[model samples]
Target: MKVLIIEDEKPAAKRLERLLLSYDDSIEVVAKLDSVKSVIDWFQTGKMLDLVFMDIQLADGLSFEVFDHVSITAPIIFTTAYDEYALKAFKVNSVAYLLKPVDDEDLSDAFAKLNTLKQAPETVNVTAVNSMDQIAAAMQMLTRQYKNRFVVKTGEHIRSIAVDEILFFFSREKATFCTLDQGKNYLLDYTLQQLIDMLDPTKFFQINRRFIISLRSVKDIISYSNSRLKIVLDHFSEQDVIVSRERVNEFKAWLDQ
Candidate 1:
């Protein structure tokens, strides 16, 4: 089987190559590409391949842009860091996706699905085979459908809080709440985990398991003992929000980005 890999991170690309070779000696990697422009150029060559493993977010832009510019017939298995809720839509709508830090069992299962597809009797719809459009649609849905407002009830009076007015989300006494700029906290129905998947990663970050903070909410950053970091938020008076030691690097990267 001839395979192509499109991933921006060199380490991830190399790791995937090693995993593929280890899984099946019959598989041959045709090429590895890093950006949307390079992929479009590769597809223009009209080189036929058995399969393609791609990352959803490339260095230049969304990998979906490749479909708009070039024609590709080979089936693709997307690799992403997105959560399960967003990924579940891909299987039902079109292509298969594996979560990042890809595992042996999942890679094996993805290969198995490719085999099943080859042996299936009927010809799969070109639109549905790759489901490129569906994948794009799902990606759009994830970014677009973020909770814009929340309704909170207080003594038979209900008020809606706009997402833009929120400062941050934190867990208190086993319930999740969003703090407003004015320092009011209202309980929310969703868990911090659910909100992490839904809220825009660029805007909100899960600095700790209990806290998902917005960029605008950060008042100051202080280096703490043992190499951890403390976060001060505007109008948040409960306690200091600490970024766990293990999460410090990723939290920094998110802030820098």
Candidate 2:
């Protein structure tokens, strides 16, 4: 009943551990790992694991990388927030998959499958073609976070700025600008929406289509009808920032957090 959990998110990993411990004390959680690199190291070190609750995305790379160079003896249960994974291929190999915000029913079902796997006869290795496809697809989706500082070119000089220095990304006159809390503005050669996607969601909130406001930029909020809200930013803006009726609840939750 030994198990390993490979998840990047701290909160998610903790929650999963708590749930598993709550479910059965007999299930021994051998290790909680964050990246493919570490997992490879663990294999090289010859760790004994009976089962794996693996996440597709990791800090360094995807979990598929573990399968690429090494044969995993333990069966894996794929856990992900999104359902874009190659599930058909996993099903062919008799691997179980679970989508996140995992509930009690899903957990119970996954455990049933786990128990069934122990009783079933051994099968052939996962198909080579499907494995190759999964690895390639994983590589395409794996991207590094913006760490330390990023460079911005201005005429003849390149300016290095820290990620925290960026206060807000806004589109004005069909061009995008990066404004700092110090009131310094720099024009970046990227769309506001694109910038929004690049930055961490926890750090930046898209107040509207044209504005990707930072956490510090949120100065105040006013309630509106139909569960809508209006937010004011510390940075200058004549245009009123309104949180859509659909997004107001989420906005309020985020604001509280």
TM-score list, all predictions? 0.58, 0.54
Clashes of 2: 0
lDDT string for model 2 (1-257, tens) is 89899899988988888888888878888889999998888878887877788887889866777877676767777788644323443444535677876666787898886676566546344223236565455444444354445578778999987878877777889988877778777888888767765776557777667777777887888887777788787766778878777777666656664
All candidates: CA RMSD in angstroms?
10.6, 8.2
Q: Look at candidate 1 and give me any clashing residue pairs.
A: none
Choose the strongest candidate by TM-score.
Answer: 1
Local error of candidate 1 at 20, Å? Answer: 0.5
State residue 242's C-alpha deviation in candidate 2, in Å: 1.6
Q: Write the per-residue lDDT of candidate 1 for residues 94-135, one digit (tens) a residue.
A: 446888999899899988876776676375432354566666
- Residue pairs clashing in model 2 are none
For model 2, the superposed segments whose C-alpha errors exceed 4 Å read 1-22, 25-51, 54-64, 69-143, 147-159, 249-257
